[model samples]
Target: MHKSIMIQGTMSNVGKSLLTAGLCRVFKQDGYKVAPFKSQNMALNSYITEEGLEMGRAQVMQAEACGIKPSVYMNPILLKPTTDVGSQVIVNGEVIGNMKAVEYFRYKKTLIPDIMKAYEKLTDEYDIVVLEGAGSPAEINLKQEDIVNMGLARMTKSPVLLVGDIDRGGVFAQLAGTLMLLTEEEKAIVKATVINKFRGDKEILKPGLTMLEDICSKPVAGVIPYVYLDIDDEDSLSERFVRRKEGGLVQIAVIRLPRISNFTDFNALESIEEVNLSYVTSPAQLQEADMVIIPGTKSTMSDLLWMRQNGLEAAIKKLADKGKIVMGICGGYQMLGDTLTDPYGVEASGSLAGMGLLPMDTVFEKEKVRTQVTGQVTSPVGHFKLLEGAAIEGYEIHMGTSSSKSGGISSFSRLEYGLAGKREVKQDGYIMDNILGTYVHGIFDSEEFLEGMVKTLLKSKGLNYEQVKTVDVKAHKEEQYDRLADTIRQNLDIEFIYKILEAGV
Candidate 1:
């Protein structure tokens, strides 16, 4: 059996995921086979693994940091919130059904066997398994049957490193209060405490750190600085969702849907120097943007109705009519069609009249489409006309099928892969004038495609579109992993962490 150490947060977004990833990198760099495990994850942002299995993207990032391929076993249970109270529950990369918060909480303990099975697989394959706990483990009411956090730590005989966010203020209270609230046995597993996302002088914090250590009976392992990393984020709480625009030649505004998913699709575009990308919900924000994007969402019809009720649908239509670039992906692509028919009530009952930007109709199916694909833009339209025959590599994870209905519209791309070995020459996406829509996620991840988009948008503004540098998105992500590992190894007590693993609890 392999040794394991788990990181539990004082609260959500306290850098648990990043720290877990950092440690995974550090362990891997030190020549130990490392893997990350999250017993349960709730996030809108998800990923399809190489085997076509679904998992949380955070584990996927951690897997990359460990120099391993992402596996569904890394994230055993994924709960994607479709409504305020209910979530679509996925187990072992397959959806079981939807469940309310109370329903899931009551039913979760039954899955301890599944969680243990996944955990055992990781322990058998790797020398170190870096486990991450969801939210705070100190929710006193819900800690009874907790399969994550203290419960998981005890099961794996793993020592815990509790992390608290200093940037959120009340860091000492957050750490001490949580430790104090835990049952005596639960508190005993916490080998160390970490103050994350700190800025300014470490000396100023030394006094309080000592007092916290005394109160909690745990050593302050580290005070981690607030560092900007270009890694993939987990959910809507991400800092990227904040609305802010840097002045640039090409302005792009993404419609911030209420139930946005896979918004990381635009991360590559944000890395470009000349592109100013901001997420907007109001109609007024669309006017200043050179290109407006309708991103993927969990509830297509509901979000489309929301856009219509809020006048954003009309605003998008007006912009497209004025020859401004309007593009959509997945559920956003479904919204751009003439109609959206959900016979089985997958999204909602009956059919919804779309924005009519594209002459296509979408029908939701019970079967979800999940696959990584490699293709090329066989043809192009509007601002991206220069990208004809450009090779593209991305993925498709959706439930709706869109088919064009008119002569004026043309296919955006042709797929040579990801059709399950049939060698499909399938045409994806629809193009009509300045309006474009596709179901491919990470389309802009390509250097060829992104550079072409920037140059075209800049030229359309009559600005000199020269001297922009090419960017490799993948290379940047790798560098970020190294940086994160370096930061954590420098600040955190890695020697003690190694000792904790070596002792095997």
Candidate 2:
């Protein structure tokens, strides 16, 4: 039988994802077949599996760390928030329906069977499964209906390690208060407590650790130091949004949509030293940016309307008209078109005018397109001219189709499904003189794609750019997994974790 352990957090963004990933790596390094599992994930950042299914990106990252292929079983329930209190609920990698927060809380109980099915499949295939919890288990109001935290641990009979973020302050209270809030039965599943994102001398933290353990009645598993590993963040709380704009050779600004999804597409460009990426939210921040990009959004029409209301749409149009390079991906690609029609009212009812930068029209459909893709660039001009003929591979996840109205303008890329499939889509996105848009989300992930983009973006700024060092994103990720494992192994009691797994709750 497969052994299991789960990482639960005191609150959101408490490093449960990273810790789970680290443990996965450690288990893999110790010569055990491992996989990552999360009963329910609520995040905008998602990934498309090889089988054309969708799952949370965090579990995908953890799967990478474990050196295993990601499956929908890793994240059976994905909630992509569309509005303040409503989200599109996806089960087994397909959309079920949109539900309000309260509705999901009441309806999620019905999904416990689906969760167990996925969990059982993973356990049967792997020697160990490292599960991750969503949000805090201390939320007394959400405890009863929860399928993600203590509930999942109970279901799997898996021991839990609670993580508290020291960087956020009140590490002790965060840890102790969580234990105090949980029921006695819930507390029994907690194996240990980990302090994440610590930045101080260990000696100075000794006394606090003692008091924390005393208050929580749990051993301190580890004090993980602050790490700056380049990994994809799962949601809007990503630290990348608050980074200071650097004066690199190329200045790229991505409009921070209210409902942005999969901003990790730009991770490769951000990794380049000569490229400075800033998440701009307003017209003022776009003033000095050489390239303005509108990223994918959960609610394209609503975000587009938001841009129009806040003068961002006008600013982008003005820049595009002035010969500045402007680009869009997925929903942003849809918004760049001349018109957006939603006869099915997927995002909203009726049709709306787009920014009119690209000569295309988008029609939102009821069904969503989710697939991994590969292709070569056919028509790349303006800032992307160097990328022409360069090989590109990525995934597509969108509910709208963008068709070119101008027959003269060619496609941005010629694509085929990355995995074997019978459905052959001839074209993707629309291309023009200085405006390019695509539904491909991870186009920049490959080495060739990044090389062309970085060199061109830098050369446009009058700087001679060269690839003095080649970076393979896949290789870099492997190195990061090892680094993360080394860090965690040095701090955490891995032997204790082994014991917890052996003695399942």
Candidate 3:
């Protein structure tokens, strides 16, 4: 039998995603095959799966914790918010079109079967499935057609663990009031209550915890401490200005464009103790950094225009000419070429001049290139010839293809590119000294690639360098989750939770 647990928050940003990931890791470590599930998630931060479908990055992070490849099934319903009140709804990995709040609420009930289908598929494959609920379940106004919170719990007949943010204050009111508002059926599904993001000593809150349990008639599961794990957050709430640690170190500036798409590319760098990462919006801020990185953008042409409007275009040129290392990924890679031609107006407007740093041009194609690639770099960079035979693996999701005049370096080829009598190099990928651009996402995860870039930066500074290795990220994440699970196990009413799990709703 596939046992599952649902983690629901009393409010948004109450550590629902992190708790789900922790549970996934915990179950996996307990010798159970586990999978993460979210019926619906609304976030601008998305990740392209190997199947070329877009899903919330939170599920991808949770899947990583379980040591599994992320799949579209993990997040069956993704709502990419286009505005404050509207979102582009994706159903079963395909876009169904944009809808306003009311329209989605009225239409969401029709998707229950779809949600069930996806959930069943996951349960059939895994020994345990950890379901994550979005926002608060006590929002009675949305309960009519809700499929993400208590409604989903009712559908799966899974035991629910209500989590409240003690760090946000009003822990007692948030827990007590939420329980008072829940329907009796919905309330019964909640087997245990969790107090998350507690900062100080747990003993001090004993009376409060007892009072909360007495009022709600539910067992207090755990009071989890606030953990700052270096994982990718998939919502706007967690996406904020991360302060640069105070230290004299190598400074790298990333242009925080208005439409920056893949900012998660820099998460690994942020964790490096010797590197300082800053997101700059103005051209003046670019002068204080040792290296400038133009991150990926969803709308390349518009962001290029944004750069030109803000005078950052000239600033980047000056930085490049001064022998500063400049890197771009995906859409940012497309912007580094000679010109960007969108004659078909696929992305936006018309053709425009690119930064012209490399002898290359990018053309927007109707068909997007999305794939998981594995290869090694074969380019000459001073005496090191960085990444000559180093194995690198990452995914590519873009609609533009690049080409160079003197022939491009071999990276990896798609089956279509190969069978069409075309080489991967000709499909628009380029690399040169101190400048590298590619359409592949998540390439920085490769230690070989990061070390190579670090070496190049050190060389540019005329300083001797030795590659400094950090912790293995995958192992580190698993260990973090293990710690979280241990904490939960020690504090929660495990017997009561197990009894609820055993008794189906």
Tell me each candidate's RMSD, in Å, in order.
1.6, 1.5, 3.6
Residue 123 C-alpha lDDT in model 2:
91
Clashing pairs in 2: none
Off by over 4 Å in 3: 50-52, 83-86, 96-106, 341-347, 380-385, 405-428
Give per-residue CA lDDT, model 3, range 350-419, as digits (tens).
7899999878888898665655565666554543364565545566767788887655533332222221
Which is the winner by TM-score between candidate 2 and candidate 3? Answer: 2
Please, what are the lDDT tens digits per residue for candidate 2 over residues 377-466? 888876778888888888999998877775523587888974575757568777777788888998889778778877766666767776
The candidate scoring highest on lDDT is 2
lDDT of each: 0.88, 0.89, 0.78
TM-score of each: 0.97, 0.97, 0.88
Question: Candidate 3: deviation at residue 323, Å?
Answer: 1.8
Residue 100, candidate 3: alpha-carbon lDDT: 94
